[model samples]
Target chain A: MYKQNITKTPKAAALAICAFLALVTAACLLCLWHTGRSSGQLTAEVYLDGELLWRIPLDQVETPYTLEVPGPQGCCNRIEVRPGSIGVVWADCPDKLCVKQGFIDRPVLPIACLPNRLVIRLCPAKDSSASHAAPDAVTY
Target chain B: METKKLTFLALCATLSLALYAAESALPPLAPIPGFKLGLSNIVTLLLLRRYRPRDAALVLAVRILLSALLFGQPLSLLYSLAGGLASFAAMCLSGSILQKKLPLLIGAMGGLAHNGGQLLTALAVTATPGVLAYLPFLLPAGILTGMFTGLCAWLADRYLPRGPSS
Candidate 1:
C-alpha cells in the first residue's frame, strides 16, 4: 500500500515543507519584533471574557497594588500591578499559566489564563497619541 | 475490526495516554501558557504510519477522552479535543501524500495545526484578541516540538514489529 502511493520526489516535498514553515516562522518573528517595540506611556489593560474590566495607566500608578478579577464559574485571577509592569500573581485555574507568566513591562505579549478567561496586556496609553502610533494599528 | 487489530489499537491508546500523563508531569519547557512538547503525538504518528488514519483517529480520541477524565479539568477537555482533532487531521493528510517516508515533516505540520486549533479555541473562549500575540511564539515552538515527536515516531516505526493493518 505504501509503495504504490509513494511520492515521486520525497526530497522536493521535504524542501517545500521546510521552506513553507521557515516563511511562517519569519513572519511570526517580524510580528514579534514589531509588537515588542514600545515607547512613551504604557497602560495595562485587564480583560475578562473580552470585556474591558480595568484600564490602568502604568505611569500614573505610584503605589503597586493587586486587583482580583472575577471569572467564569466563580473563579478569579489576582493581578499584581506595579508602576511599570503587570502580572497575574494568583489564579484559581488548574494550570495557573497566567500566574506562571510572571510580570510584563512591555507590550510584546499578553498574560492569559485560559481556564479563567482572563487576559492582562500592556500597550501604549490611549491618551498619548505619539507613542500609540504603530503597535495597536497593526493587527495579526 | 478484527479482534487482533482492535486489541493493538487499544494498546496504542493506552501508550499515548501514558505518554500524555508523563509529559504533563514535567516542568513546562517555556513560561508560555498552553505550550507543550506533545510527546503523545509520537504514538499518533506511529499509528498513522503503520495502520490507517481511522485507526489512528480512534486511538487519539480514546487518549484525549481518558486523559481529560483523569488529569485535566472540564475546560481543558475543550482545548484537548480541538488540538487533538487538528493534529490528527494534519498527520493524516501529510502521511497520505508523503507516505511513510517523512514522519518528521508530517509531525511538524501536526504540531503547528494542533497549536493553531488551540489558539482559535482560546480566542473564542476568552473572546480576547490580545491572545493572538502568542502566535509568534507558538509557531516556532510547534515546529521544533513537532519535529522531535515525528523523529521519535520514525524511530519507533523503524524498530517496532509490524501490526495488522485495518
Candidate 2:
C-alpha cells in the first residue's frame, strides 16, 4: 500500500518539461547554426585548452603532414593535415571520437578529445584567398 | 541491510551492468563526442521507483563501478565516474524535489548534468575553454537520449513485477 505505481505526472509538471525540452531544442538549433557558418580562412587551427597550438593552411600545403599534439597527463593526439582538409588520424583516448570524425574540409564544430582537451577547428584565415584557393593542380 | 534486500540489489546491479555492456557494444549513434543512449540507466530509474532512494543510489554505484571495471579503461573510469556521480546527484535531487512525479524530466536533467560533468572534466584536464563549444551539441543529445532512457525505465517499471519477490 505504501508504494503505488506513479504512472502519470501532473499536467502542470508535464507541460513544464515539454516547454523545457522545446527550449533546449531551440538552443541546440542555434548552436548548430553558429557552427554551420563557413570560415573565411582555410586554415585548420588546433587548440590545446583554448591555446593555439598549430595553424595549418590547407591551401598552401603541397603534402599531407601529421602533427602530434601533446595533451594533459602525457596524452597525445595525431592530427593529419592535407590540402584544404584536416582530421585526427590517431588519438590515445577512450572515446576515439576525434579520430572517428574523419576528414573535415569545411568550417564547422571542432573535433575534440575531451580527455586530452584538444580541439581542432577549421577557421577563417586573414588571407581571404587562402580560403578559396585553387585545387591542387599537381594531383591532376 | 537484510540478506534478501542485499541479494535483490545485487541482482539489479548485475542487470544494470549487462545493459551497460550492451549499450556500449552498439555502434556510436552519432559522430558527436560523448553522445550515448544511456541504456543502463533503466535499472537505476526502475530501482528508484520500486525501492527507496538509498537503494537506488547503491544500485547505481555498483553498476557504474562494476561496468567500468569490466569493460572500461582507467581514464574512462574517471570520466564516467565524474559523469555518473553528477547524473546520479541530479536524479536524486530531482526525485526528492519532484517527489518522483516525473521520472522523464529527471532523466533528461540527469543526462544533461552527466554531459556537463564530462565537459567540465575535459575542460579541466585540457585547460581548454574552447571545449565549451561542445555543449551546444552535447546538451541536446543528452536531453534526447535521456528521454529515451527515461521512457525505457517508465515502460519497464509499468510492466516489471513489483515488490521484493518480483
What residue pairs are clashing in model 2?
Answer: A41-A124, A41-A125, A49-B128
Model 1 chain B poorest 10 in a row by lDDT = B92-101
The alpha-carbon deviation from the true structure for residue B53 of candidate 1, after best TM-score superposition, in angstroms, is 0.4
Model 2 ranges off by over 4 Å: A1-9, A43-106, A109-140
The true-versus-predicted C-alpha distance at residue A100 of model 1, in Å, is: 20
lDDT of 2 at B160: 82
The native-contact fraction of candidate 2 is 0.31
lDDT of each: 0.82, 0.77
| Candidate 1 chain A: worst-modelled 10 consecutive residues by lDDT | A131-140
- TM-score, model 2 to reference: 0.66
Clashing pairs in 1: none
Error of 2 at A138 (Å): 37
lDDT of 1 by residue, A1-140 (tens): 67544545666677888898899889998888876674467898777886778888998989999998888888888888899889888889888888888999878777888788787777778643433222321111
Q: Which tens-of-lDDT digit does each residue in B63-145 have in candidate 1? A: 98899899877778898999998888877877766756789999999998898888898879867676686789888888889
